[model samples]
Target: CSASSGCGTGILANYFDHYTVFNKPVQSGIAVGDFVTLEISSSELFSRAFMLYIFPILALFMGSYMGMRLFPATELWQISFGIFGFISALLLTKYFVK
Candidate 1:
């Protein structure tokens, strides 16, 4: 793995040439430009994927449902609430999920 940024005595790794994996624990004697094997559990991966993909959708649906129950006369309000819910979910996930 190649070092992306140096933090204190540790280095952040750039994985798959796209994503940066931070706060990784490194073993002694491993230095910059060295190849390393990273292992992630299936359950952990699934949970991360679910949080990234499913949570926002569920929030949007719930928001739309709330909008329908609160304002049954207007389709515009329902759509607006759904969009608001979607955006709120995205922000929550980005800041709070990790």
Candidate 2:
């Protein structure tokens, strides 16, 4: 092969070698619209699967803060605070990393 032809072939070979890594797939999961539509479409769904998924998180914070104030010296109080702190950090990382 000519000098230019050899270089062109080398570049093509490099591209093919890395194609699997370089062509990684999209990482999208469930969309927010589906959540919204589910809640809108069925009252049972809003109470059952949707609320079940959502409420533990809401309860975690609500119960944690109230427990923090109510039982300041308890070991369980410390655990609640730790969980609250951990969730906050995870949420912050997710928000800022994007």
RMSD of each: 8.8, 18.4
For 1-98, candidate 1 gives per-residue lDDT tens digits of: 33336542134223324556678779999999999888889999888777778989998998898899899999887888898999998998888767
TM-score of each: 0.74, 0.32
Q: Estimate, for each residue in 12-58, the C-alpha lDDT of model 2 and write its tens digit.
A: 56555433223334346856344322123577656554344454566
Q: Looking at candidate 1, what is the lDDT of residue 36?
A: 86
- Measured on C-alpha atoms, candidate 2 has an lDDT of 0.56
Q: TM-score of predicted model 1?
A: 0.74
Top lDDT: which candidate number?
A: 1
Collision count for each candidate, in order: 0, 0
